[model samples]
Structure formats: C-alpha cells, structure tokens
Target: MARIAIIFLTFVCVFGGATFVKSIEEDFIRLPLTSLHSRSRRKADVVDPNAKKVNLWNDRNLQYGINITVGTPPQPFILHLDTGSADVWVPSVNGDCPYLCKAVNKYDSSKSSTYKEIPGKTFTLGYETGGLSGSVAEETISFAGLEIKNQVIGIGENQDTDLNSYPLDGIIGFPWSGATSQTDPKSTILGNLHKNGHIKKRFACLKLHQVNEQPGGELLLGGCDVEAEHWGRVYGNGYWEIPIDKVEAFGTDGNSLDSICGPGSSVPDCRATFDTGAAVIGGPSYLIDPIASKLGASKYDENINDYIVDCDDQTLGNLEFTFGKFKVVMTPGDYLSKDGNTCTLGFARLDDLSALLLGDPFLRKVTLLMNQEKDEAGLAKSNIDKPVARPT
Candidate 1:
C-alpha cells in the first residue's frame, strides 16, 4: 500500500437521476457500481463540460474521508455521504469500475500492510452511477486526531464488479466527509469506535458545494471551529437518520416561500440520510416540487431533478429545518453561492417530491453531525463550531 498520510475525510459525488430533486421519488440503484461503466446513465448524472464546476468530476461523492491505520499502513479514501443509498465501500485491486475509477498506480505495500479480514461478512455499496462491493474485514481507520480500529471494512471482488483497470484502492462511503477520503471504511471505523466505547462520541460533519454551481467551499468533521475537550465535544454525525422538521422555499422575504405544512407532522416523512455520496439534496414527491408549485415558486424541468437556475434573484430565500433544539435557518445566499460565471445558483426538485433528501446545497449551510451508534445527529449552524468561508 502506498504511504498515505493520516486519514482525512473529504467528499465528492453528484446528484443524478430524478430522485435527486427534493421530494421526488424515482428508482435509484442503491448498490455501488459493479464497475465505473455503470455511470448511472440518467438525466441528472451527466455534467456539462462547459458548465460552472469546470472540474467534470466535481460531484460530492468524490470528496470524503480521512486517513486510517490498517496495521501500520496508511490508507486514504473519500466517502460518498449519500442519503439516497446505503452500504460502504473501498478501492480494491479487482476490476470493472471504469466510469468512476481513478488509478493510483501501484500501492507500495512494503512499509506495513496491517489489515484483518472478517471471514464471512460481505459488504455491497451501489448507486445509479457505480459501486464498490467487497467482503467485510477489520482494520484500523484513523482521522486527523482520532482513530478507530477492528471495524468491518469492504474488500471488492475482482470477478464480481468492474473496477476500472486503475480504480481508487480507497473507499466509497455514506457517512459525512469533512476528514479525508483516503481512508477505508471511514464511517464504520468512526461508528465502531463510538459503539465499542473506544471513544465517548464520534462525529461526521460536511460542507458541500451545490450540484450546479462551482467555486464554493468545504465541510468539516470533529467540530472544526469548536474546540473539543475530550474529542467528544467535537460534534459530528458519523451516521444519522433525521426527520424533516420543516421545508420551506423562501421568497425574497427570507421566509417560507412555499407552504409545505399540511403534511400532519412539521417535517417530511422519510429516513433523511446525511450522505456524502449525493451532490444535490433529494426527497420524495408531495414534499418537494408539489409544495413549490403550491407556493408559486420557480422550478425548472431541465429534464432532470437537479437543475441550474439563472438565479440572479440572489436570495434563494430561507429554508429552515429543525433537529432537536436546533432550528437551522438556510438562507438563499447559501445556495446562491457565488460560483463560476453562472447566471444563477443551482437548485432542483425531485420528480416525486414526497420524501425529503438534503444534499450538499443544504449541508453546506448547516452543521450536520452523525451518530451511527445512536442513529442520531447534532444539527448546528454550519458556522456553529466552524468558520464559514465565503466563495471567492
């Protein structure tokens, strides 16, 4: 294994297909790509090479992870941080992943390859794009200041998936990536540590860029701006499942632009995932566009759920979501992130708009913490414990 620095948590994944739009429900492949070739051929997945995020691979799935010590070898990788899908993944020496594989050449495993296999547990992760399938093994995964060991990790099988001839020998994750994307099984590592008492608490926080805009900034894990006393003070959600307390499209008034309220509960109905895999926020029908139409908000039929707006309106308005005691207020400027030469910030609606899915656009505005052990999270101001960097 090539020498990787301390595991960092970062992320990169795009919003593809119709389901990516909030409140929209579409058939999305929940499994990791058997290979890169299965590029989730759909409406939202493809990028306009000439668009704002000049980097064609500027999706959120690609920017997750930190470093981890498997025995003594330093392994690095990114997490998908997807709420739309499930399972975890890592880059393996197998084959089949053409579309999303990035070759790191030969991993000089001469230093010390310290990884333990978990015998019979098989792990599979997929998407409309591709996936990483492998067996569950135990290894030591570490971040900047913390470490988790003996957690179940994924190992791809060559014959089973199409891992591009030179794919990343890293990870595909669902946990938030504010650390490093070069670590293997980062979410499991963090969750295992918290569950096994290795750590009092663990967190996974993220800062994401919009699906359509570019020139935005990052996400943080382990309470970046907020200093932790025993590390637990670092608020992060390595894993989480939250209820949508509220979803309102703000008009120029910075208030709820749309009235999505009649839904019995104040929030949306669905297992909201704090994922690094998806780029745009996603949701089921009756929750996203329908509500938008109800409020007379502007929507686009880019022929895809994830759409770009010529939004010179500046104020995408305020969309608030409450979790526990925290009531997060999302401003239009957050989504109106000053990126590229675009006529406006990017925004989209899912075809189904029933179940709500929060993506990078919303994540970057608030601090999303994950607690896999408790299936809970700490939602704070994106600038709560961290400094919010303005788009340059």
Candidate 2:
C-alpha cells in the first residue's frame, strides 16, 4: 500500500485533488534554468551533431528500451520507448499473453506481409498495473534507422496479472499525434514521419540513464541534442509543458518556507506534466499535504500507502519546482529514495489539480528536448555528450 514510484501510462488514472495551472496558449522562451550550476570542460555539442540515434536499454532505472522492427519481413521487438505513450504496441501472436508476454517477442500477424486489419477495431491498453485487450493493426514499424510506414499497432488481446511482470514486449509511444489510445489519429510513429515528408524536424530527444550506468541513453529522432550547458526553454500545451512556478519548502539557505502549491492557491497556475510514463511525483492532496508536512513525511500508512522519508532527513531540505523563472532544484538527494533504509517520498497524490505528473523522479535529472518545431520544451543538465555518430 505504501510504495511511491508508479509509471503506468496507457490512459493515466491516479486520483486525489487540488493542483491546477493551465492557460498558456503558447509563447514562452525564457532561459537560465539555473545554468545547471555550471560545469564545463568544453567540447560537448549538438545541433544535429549527426542526429539519428536509438540506443537506450536501462530497466533498472525502472525502464527504457529500444530494439523494435515490426511486421512485414521485420519482426524484432523490445520497445518501451514511451515518452508517456501515444501508440505503437505489441504482444500479439494472436494474443493470450501471460508470463508477462514471455520475454516479449510476439507479434506474428501471421508473419506479416505488412499486417493491416483495423476492421472491427479493439485496442484497450491502460496500465497502472493492468489492462491490454488488443487487436488494432497496420504494421511496418522499424526504428532509429528510420522506416515507419503504416504504423498504428497494438495487438495484445487480453492481459492483466501485471502483464506478466513486463520484460518488454510493448509500448513505443513517442507521444505527439493526437496522443494515444490509438485507432489512428494520424497513426503516430512520429506522426507518420511528420506526415510523409519523413521528418525535417518535428523533434524528439530524451536521455535518462543513471542507476548503474551503462545504458548510455539516446533517443534523438528528427533532430536536437544541442547541449553545451544547462539548457532552457519551456512552454507547452502540446505535452511537455512546465510552469509549476512554485511548490515550496526549502531551508538550509535555499529559502521559501511556505506555499505548497503555487500562485494564489486553490489550484491556480500549477502545471507539471513531463510524463515519461510517470514514475512518481504525482500531485494534489493540497499539493502533497504541505510538501509532505515539511518533509518530515508520515501519514499514508495504510500499511504501505507510503510516506516514509528519513533517508537521513532526505538531504536536509530543499524541494523547489518554479519552472518559469527557472529554479528546478530538488535536493534531499532529489526527492528521496532508498530501499534498505526504507526512505520513499518522491511525492504522490492525484485527482488532477489541472496537471502534475512530472514522472521518473523528475525525468532522471534532466536532458530533454521535445520541440515539435516551435511548440518548445528543452531542459538541460543531463548531457554526457556522446551522440554524434550516425552517418552510414
């Protein structure tokens, strides 16, 4: 009952109350995301620094993969490249999956000739624990090397039992085109490769990789890696939004000691969704009950409804979230996590105070681009600067 690290992503559900902040029709380019504190030995660069990359693997940071191939003479699988999903599924050898789709490889479509079968449609999905109910075809997927013909997949058939525990045999929603539940709202595979032009720039860039390191994150499609320093630029309505502008509780010189939500309260200007499937940082419950009672964290003990915190007083103060004039800080080792000492407190609660998903413990500490050509969204700090190879 008390665990706090959810990632689900299919339709999104979590409920509680209070956290609103929506109304930015578009127009934000502010920078200075705290300059990520500065650190440069120089040499890092990106602005297409060769673009085309698709390497990700990490499953211990909880999830991240990319192997894909799909249908018509393709096959292969792996997936989970979800930027919080938008469509592109798996687990179909005619459905009936169980052992978490058994190490995932399925998707026969009778061996594919480019599958195709969006007839009576079915497609369910949804996961915070379960639900798949598939069948909704149209294949020819591919990845990184690029090649996305028909797209719109799904397949499953019936699932639950926690999809067998996931070893990865599904999920590939790079989020965009009508944003998932797929029945073909433009087929999203990068919006059918930017509507047939095959991408001149529609944007996509994510890096995430830390806990054990070797996954060497990478997902740049279309273009953007432009790193060199603590990047910035925010604005959304297209998904990747940010403008929390306040969350509060900080001391030890960090300042702010009050206001747990934002602006004039009552859930006003709060916004927070970055949703890489949402690993945790939900919101509402009057903004996580006063930042979990000034970080002493308790209540929610329905045995394990979770709120523990004390992994050594979780870094001793500082939680900030500002986002419009920058700020972004999160010390306490960034929200707290520790299994043996039993820490837990990445913040959770939700009913939707307008928006607040910010998942993956605040996106594995930054480095995201998502600029659907001017719709804007870029954040910095996670740049180890390695991508620049593709050019066969």
Work out the TM-score per prediction.
Answer: 0.57, 0.36
For all candidates in order, the CA lDDT equals 0.39, 0.58
TM-score of 2: 0.36
Q: Which candidate comes out best when scored by TM-score?
A: 1
Give model 2 RMSD, 1 decimal.
Answer: 16.8
In model 2, which runs have C-alpha deviations exceeding 4 angstroms?
1-38, 49-69, 73-89, 97-108, 114-140, 143-145, 148-158, 162-169, 173-204, 207-219, 222-225, 228-275, 281-293, 301-327, 330-361, 369-392
Cα TM-score of candidate 1? 0.57
Tell me the lDDT of candidate 1: 0.39
Q: How displaced is residue 124 in candidate 2, in Å?
A: 20
1-392: candidate 2 lDDT, tens digit per residue: 00111243222221222111111111112122222321232222224434566667665555566777887798877766666566666777766644434544677788788888988997766554556677787778766556787777777768764543245566777654444344555545665776766566677678776545665367666664444233333443335555666777764444547667777656566766676655567766777767767655765643433476555552356677765544566566555655565766766666443566676656777777776655556666566532221111
